[model samples]
Target: MLLPTRPCGPLLAAVLPCLASPLAAQSTDPGNSEPEPAGPTIVVTGALESRSLQSLDTPGLGLAVDADQIAAVNAINTEDVIRYAPGLVVRKRYIGDANATLSLRNMHTTQTPRALVSVDGFVIANFLGASFDTAPKWGVLAPGDIARAEIVYGPSSARYSGHALGGVLRLETEPVSRTAVSLGAQSFFQSYRYYETDEDLFGYALDARADLALGSGGISFAWRHFENEGQPQQWRTVAPGTPYAAQATIDDALGFPLRIAAQDSVVDAREDQFRLRANQELGGDWELRALAALLLDRDGTSEPKSFLTDGDGQPTFVGIAGVTLGRSRSAELLAGLGLKGHLGDWSLDLAVSRFETLDDRSRQSDPADLATGLIPQGGIVTDENARWTTIELTVERAIGPHRLALGASYAGYAGRSRTAPVSDWRTAAPGPVRNASGGKSELIGLFVEDAISLTPALEATLGLRYERWRAADGFLQNAGARVDYRGRTDAAWSPKVALAWRVSDTSELSASLAWATRFPTIGELYQASLIAYGPNVGEIDLGGFDPDLAPERGFDMQVTARQRLGTIDLTLSGYRQNVRDTLFGQTILVAGPGEVPVSQSLITNIGAVETWGVDFIVAAEDVVIEGLSFDGNISWIDARIEGNPLNPALEGNRFPRVPEWRANASLRYAVSDAFELAASVRHQSTPERNLENSASSRCDTFFCVSSFAFVDLKASVDFGPFALDLGVDNLLGERAFVFHPYPGRTFVAGLRWTGGRP
Candidate 1:
């Protein structure tokens, strides 16, 4: 849960030249050659995998960061690794937010399924749905467990599936090396002040890890515990039926005057993570790797506060539609196994994984129930069975001038949930089912790619991926009335091309183009949305899902240039992508005369959109001074809707949540090998609330995204067997919003001690 706030340098993170140069590898290290290795290992330095661990060899622009850099970041969650990266944003509401959403370029924050996120080659991004409720499982990772993180932008790699349309991210964990044991702890405090609310929030984490020497290899076990309290996620306004407050009223996001009522929730969370990994070299260059992880989440909102006062200056909560004062707990498990080695003339790779939620249940109670103190009251929602499984087989061989690679992948998902009125909210016996749903989704993919050496200066790659997708066992129940949905299947072909030119020893150029098809997620295909997220938090009734909705299909293209100037590295990249049949949530109205012109919200194929962007990255060591180094990048994107017949008024409007300009930079000075000082700055322009680029974008108000600039500083000191960390985020104490108010200014301090290895 630690990462540098600075942008990962172009050299460490993006647009790097191919590894080993495909042309050179084809001739020098063909899989056809056999190597003899009969060595016994006591400590597993690492596994010898046929495939390269670095994914930056992919056609598109990519970025990377290592453990040394991660240790410098003042972060509390794994997702914060990319918070300040170029063309990236982690919609993290607070220090311990479980719904931290990640946005890649044009994908925006709410489109969670568009990105392919993996850890140690195991898929962690949730394809269950594209929203906060189904965010990637970052909490499953033990804090301080990652060694490196890399990301490839766009869907130009045939080795990956359409989820790469947004981007592909991979987190590499530390390999078990020698027998070692370590323990670490960190604590953080944030001072926050906003409209009608002010307070201080604090959190901390404890981590322990052990690496043991096993028979012929090594195994590692890690555990982490975290607890935190966050500010209220939202504030209510504009409700009738009563109590007037003493505080002054304020204008809302749309300039509407209203009194701030009770807050949504001030979350209190406790989480625990346990993970185990084992690696063994099976002789003959073959290796086996295995992983098992578990995560438990306990969150609740026990205190409900209402700003409004009754007739005698007493607090009242009668006007609110819902006031939750209950807790939710869930347990999740993830397991993976992989094998890679030589198979005759080809190098073969196999991977399999399963992620499941063993128990997921929530208890919610209306505030009125607290007054009555009934023995049995409130409601219980259960999602007892939800899981995903993935399997992959890949092989590669160098034949003549072509390096041929082929792979097949399968991913399956299933989920079921029920909501019922209970006797007791905490340990309830269900009375009658109020709402329920069950469904399944799956994808089967086959891909082939060939890297050819056109000449010494030129290299080309051609690739294609074919996918078959299906959805079944869909059902929705309301008040015991069940409705079943028909099953559906789809097939699509994605094609990709990439070219790289070694201009000279000082420079290089590359370009890539691809076509990808992204199918609908399970929730988007079956569930009817009741509460809206983002800026449009007002009450809405989205009636039903379109089971036959068209899949998102698009063309992505990019060009890049890189140059080395002494100790400095510079990279410029540009990209353009257009997605048709874009699956979006919007409103349409078609009321007849004499009927009320009410907008009907729907999640459907919302026509088409085109996006264009440019990024400039600069990384330099020993700038003007010997100890000074800098890493920075700037991005500009213009994403707009092309047309939408159903909501034509939105034509030519900016895409929601995509900022027009954003930049990240970090400067560091090493006083010595044991001491370092670093400073980082993050900035982003205000974004639109909806597809129409609504005029109601309030920059510094509740429920709105605002242009923000934050400065952070960190100082670290290392002793032989111990380390000390001191950092402050948002040094300027600037105010901003990402639907929920962003943290004001936070101070962090940590201490770690290690001793077993030396």
Candidate 2:
């Protein structure tokens, strides 16, 4: 069924006429009226400002963070601006971690492909891998350049694709209003202490921006350079109390004895980013906007601990085994153009965007032994590239008391990934070609939505979307073997409906229901296989591809209420979703006589899953005392797998990475217009299972990690055009693990200078 089974026709029929009657009555009134006096003229001057759809009118729960809100917090990275957002989490490992991704609702942190991220309506989520390995390039925009960020929860809007099943993050950059220049700098330090590892890490960032006004248009340019030295969060596991730990020999890798039981992988990273934006006013209420961004990132080296010995004096470890050294470089470019205007009684908007990964290269080395100074026997080099192009057109019109919108979008992607052997790890010289894979995908969607005002205080929205997706040109090459994979195509029709009732001027209640389908990405469909060796399972080949993998389909329902009482605002929301053909990685044991057992991991379809959650948010401004405020939110979620064909015994297992309870709260006090102080707290319950839900793979106490809580404090001072800010994160030094142990207490300080607007 395209829509929910519930009947909404009667409700629409009763509301539409009630909303139109008042307007009709006003137009037909025949009473004689006196001449109206002319009011003072108001001139709006700026860089081509256009009115777009508002989130408050959308079908889902939406949250907005403006520049003032962003500046009130001590945010080093752009993603940090949304760190305390309700029902959301940013999986940031360290200051310079490139794989930072976002999770919302009941989605797991590793399900990066299920969410959508955009900057100025331009797609930024990497499609090269479609998993945790491919995250949005947050470095492209500096936190200072953001004017506002909007987070829309769920795929309840016809304007978005099914990829927004988890949610969507839309970032808008600062627009040039007048000629101005700004400069900013920041420094940070952290004391990190882990099992047998202790160190102090530091980082710094520099940024500058220039804006110019020309005629009826304006242009802006921004640049940033960032560098950081991060403590080791990853460790080489030896299984506590295992025989390998007892037999392992210690070696000096970081001027200290490094044992297999307690070793860390340290990282050094840097990034450079630049962006240009221009907007112009066309004749007859038309406007044009363009944007271009470039980002470059490099991880000089990720040094692992030394764990191998040559039995002599020199250590014989390198690459994947012992003290390994790895380097990676990546570059991305994003460009877009948009046009908006009016046609008769209809408003039209058109945009075209292109995003490309210009270069993505990595090299690693592992020497046999230092005695002979021989080249690494186990070294590899990888190269991957991806490009995406999207075109969207939307038109809106009003009919009687109802507003209608129609939109069409087309998106396509092309990607290539290859891995080759390295003859010399030091020089990164190519030895022999190993494997290569490439693929292409195309998506087209058409949607229409109507907002009907049934009454002055009641509104209803009905939307439907039709989408078609296809994958083709899939091929894999290994050694002298070449294989052409079969192409796949799928189509789906999604429907959404929403109702909003204004209980009073200060209260509102809303409910929404939607059905959406998400298709697989190029990486999930065509990426080459992976292999790993385990102590218990030797030579495990995990490169199984299911060409017939089905698309995931889901239904979502949500209800929310918002109320304002004096200076306090409260919001409560509840949601439930059910999905079919959910994709997940699972392990299959392969055993034979006289050979070690092998556990092959592969992506497979799980039959069904369900998730339900409740969230509440409370905020008060200037309550009790002037300039004192409180903002907080709490969430409770219950997610479980209902069916699994491969292993029915896994049914009813809790979804991985989904904490049952999560909460965040903050209190802020403004000593004056120039000074402010704030404190925040966050907590999360322990997870119930791993990604695969394997009982045998359970960790010591919990499934994978333990419950933890953290506290943060921040202070800021403004000196006219200059500003200073300080922050202490994890103030309590809470030792928490989410796959990787989080950083301990850290300190940050920043200074900024801004020129007055012309």
By TM-score, the best candidate is 1
TM-score for predicted model 1 compared with the true structure:
0.89
lDDT by residue for model 1 over 54-163, one digit each (tens)? 42236667766545456567877888766556788888888888888778888778788788998877888888877777788897676477777777788988888888
TM-score against truth, every candidate: 0.89, 0.86
Candidate 1: segments with Cα more than 4 A from true spot: 1-57, 238-241, 245-248, 367-377, 529-543, 590-597
Instruction: Name the runs in model 2 displaced over 4 angstroms.
Output: 1-53, 238-262, 306-323, 367-378, 528-543, 589-598, 689-703
lDDT tens string, model 2, 665-748?
878899999999888888888775575555532332211465667788899999989999999989988877666667778899
Q: lDDT of candidate 1 vs native? A: 0.75
The model with the greatest lDDT is 1
Worst 10 residues of 1 by lDDT: 39-48
Clashing pairs for model 1 are 3-73, 4-73, 13-63, 13-64, 14-62, 376-423
Local error of candidate 2 at residue 600 (angstroms): 2.6
